[model samples]
Target: MKIDIDYTPENKAVIHSYMRNVAQGNTAGAAADAAADAAKLYDAGSATVQVNSVVKAESEAGIDLKAGEVKVSTENQTTTNVSTYYKVPNDGKLEQL
Candidate 1:
């Protein structure tokens, strides 16, 4: 829930103007108006506010993890390669997959 602003020249100019207006003894009402407008322009026509959520489903029927696998679906994407890993054993010997 954090936003990072890349301060380009155009953005810097708008921000400076807004600050100058506030410092010039402007009315609180006008300053608030300017701030709202600046916020609109800053986020204009951008998908930056939309958030994507990941959902992990719980199954009612039990499944065996030892022999079962998971399938991930990404939008219009295909798998190129696959790799598997096994847990490291507490003993010196490495666990097999």
Candidate 2:
């Protein structure tokens, strides 16, 4: 969940101004500190959803993985029927995944 953000010049200028308001020493140092703190927060919030959460959502939507492929139903929460699978070997994404 590492982030690499290159702030546009205009945004960087605005951030420098804002950070200068509370700090007394070097303005660039203050802005770098602020950016570092923001990166930590951004990393913390940027995590892949837990496997259980994904499983629950897929279960609720009646999507299942079988034979190394995905099978979905026309209606949410309905049972899967092999004949109705939308994306398959003849259709793609399962192989891509």
- Candidate of highest TM-score: 1
Clashes of each: 0, 0
Tens-place lDDT digits, model 1, residues 1-97:
1223445664566556666776786786677868775564445212223234444544344444777865544344234323332322122222233
TM-score (all chains, Cα) for each model: 0.30, 0.21
Candidates in order have lDDT scores of 0.47, 0.39
Q: Which stretches of candidate 1 lie over 4 Å from their true place?
A: 1-4, 41-97
Per-residue alpha-carbon lDDT of model 2 for 46-90, expressed as tens digits?
A: 222211111112332344556565555442343332232122211
Residue pairs in clash, model 1: none
TM-score for candidate 1? 0.30
After the best TM-score superposition of candidate 2, give how far the Cα of residue 60 lies from its true spot, in angstroms: 53
